[model samples]
Target: MSKVVLITGASSGIGKSIAHYLIEKGYIVYGTSRNPREKVVNGINFVALDVTKTETIQQAVKEIAEKEGKIDFLINNAGMGITGPIEETPDDEIKRIFDTNYFGVIKVIKAVLPIMRKNNGGFIINITSIAGYMGLPFRGIYSATKGALELTTEAFRMELKDFNIKMTNIAPGDFATNIAAGRYHSPIIKNSPYEKKYKSTLDLMDKHVDKGKDPLIMAEKVYAVMQEKNPTIHYKVGEFIQKFSIALKHILPDKVYEKMLMKHYKL
Candidate 1:
């Protein structure tokens, strides 16, 4: 029997790409969207699930477990993006992002854990971002959420070790996707303190996404990780510079790395 895999935020973008690739590779794949109008897409079973809603998370997992007997793998790819100067961004918006990106992931994992424990083994892969490794200009909230998730996964892995459940975080750099469209951008206040710099950084961020690598690169990386017996706690998939920036942060002094980022963002 083929393994059963569940992926969140599968309606489009990176989640969609992963669903398609895994299904083609012979895994029984179920992809979730907040509201899926279709029953299936390109062989992926589509289910309705909103990470922000606990009831929906439970129902979706229950339905899958009832049908498949066990969920062999889980890909927590459901997350939203936000960009704005820290002082200018709304508190509600920050909470909203954390609710979806961080809390939502934990909810889904909780719903699936019992099923995985019963079956004696399972794997979980979280779709974090390279931005999480550092505090990027105008994208601080987004970075914090992913960074928190990364640390949580480290602790989660140790807790699940005795249960034979494995967990890992995959941080992708810029990818050509509709994420830019979905992101919440705090309005640029004219003549405000951060107005000029915020506008410039926002434009630069979009350009990077426009020229980003194909989403399939992430999908390929996901598939490769699933094939491992003892996967590492973290994996990064992106261009040389994007991946290297994370390394530079560790190797360079605090001010030096800060200067590099300020230079990159033209702050």
Candidate 2:
């Protein structure tokens, strides 16, 4: 029997690409979007889901459970981007970022865990970012959200092993996607003293994203994890430089790593 897989934020970008890839691999794929009115993509079922809303999450999981009987994989890919000086970022903006990136992920995982437990075992891939490993100059909150998620995944890995449920944090460096368009920016950034620097940094960030690695490569990584009988606790998808930078951060001295980041981002 084909595995039943559900991926959030599948309307476009990495999630959408993953959904397509999984379908090609013969997994039954269900992709979620906040707008039910969005046109459905061929070969993928789109479910209405707003990760910020608990009711919608429960309903989406229930709807899938009713039809599929069991969920074999859950991809927590629904997230939004926020940018601005951390000092100038509005409280609401910070909350919104965490809501979609951190809390939203927790909600979906909670809703799906019981189903996975009932099925004996299942795999969960949480879509995180390389920024989660360290704080960036202007995107501190976004980093914080992903950092919180990575730590939470670590805890989940230990707690869920007894039930045979596999959880992995899939951190991608940068990918060509529509995330730039949907990214949130604090209004205060316009008036802040650091506006010029913020704008320049934001442009630099976008430049790298524009040249980001292929989403198909990320999909392949996801598929590889799916094929694993026992997957690793973490997997990264991105260009060699980005992957190497992550390793370098771990072993390098704090000042050295900080200088490297500062030089790279021109901060």
Candidate 3:
């Protein structure tokens, strides 16, 4: 029997693309969506799951485990983004974003831990972003959430070692996806002190996203990771320039990195 795989936010974008890729590779893939539809891609199964809801996550895992008797790999790719000046973004908006991007991930991992533990081995892949390595202008909150997940996944990797389970962080720079489809914007941005700058910066941000590489590249990277007996703890996917940017952030001085980011976004 093929190894069973579960992916969240599989209705579209990276999640959906990866699901199709894995299906083509003959993995028994179970993809989740907040509101699942009858849409089918090859043999990938869509399960109704809202990462933020513990009950739904529990049920989805239960259904999969019951039928497959094992979950060999799990990809937590469900997340949303928020944009605007950090000061103008309301506390509630930040909370909602974290609830979906950070806390929701935690909830799903917790729900599946027991099954993986019982099985004695499994792979958990968390979808992070290049922004996780550094805060971006106007998208600071979104950065914070991914940054939190990055650190969290690192800790999870260390702890899951004893169980023979593995955790990896897939940090993609920017890919053409509808990830921004459900992105939230601070209502007060229009009247804020940074209003004009925020608008221009956001426009530039959208332009970059529009020209981003196909998400299938990331999906192929994901496939490569799945073939590994022991994948790297973190894999960065994107254009050479974008991946180089991540490397530069590590070696460059704080001031230098800030200048680079500012120049890229024309801030």
In terms of lDDT, which candidate is strongest? 1
Q: Candidate 3 local accuracy as lDDT?
A: 0.89
RMSD of 1: 0.5
Q: Give the per-residue lDDT of model 3 (tens digit) for 67-116.
A: 89999999999999899888788899999999999999999999888999
Q: Of 2 and 3, which scores higher on lDDT?
A: 2
Write down the worst ten-residue block by lDDT for model 3: 185-194
- Per-candidate TM equals 0.99, 0.96, 0.96
Candidate 3 segments whose C-alpha is farther than 4 A from its true place? 39-41, 188-191
Q: Give me the displacement of residue 142 in model 3, in angstroms.
A: 0.7
Q: Which of 1 and 2 is the better model by lDDT?
A: 1
lDDT of 1 by residue, 1-267 (tens): 999999999989999999999988999999999888889878999889999999999999999999999999999999999999999899999999999999999999999999999999999999999999999999999999999999999999999999999999999999999999999999999999999999999999999999999999999999999999999998999999999999999999999999999999998
| lDDT, candidate 2, at 137 | 91
Please provide, for model 2 over 45-160, each residue's C-alpha lDDT reduced to its tens digit, 9 standing for 90 to 100: 88899999999999999999999999999999999999988878889889989999999999999999999999899999999998898988998999999989999999999999
Ranking by lDDT: 1, 2, 3
Q: What's model 3's TM-score?
A: 0.96
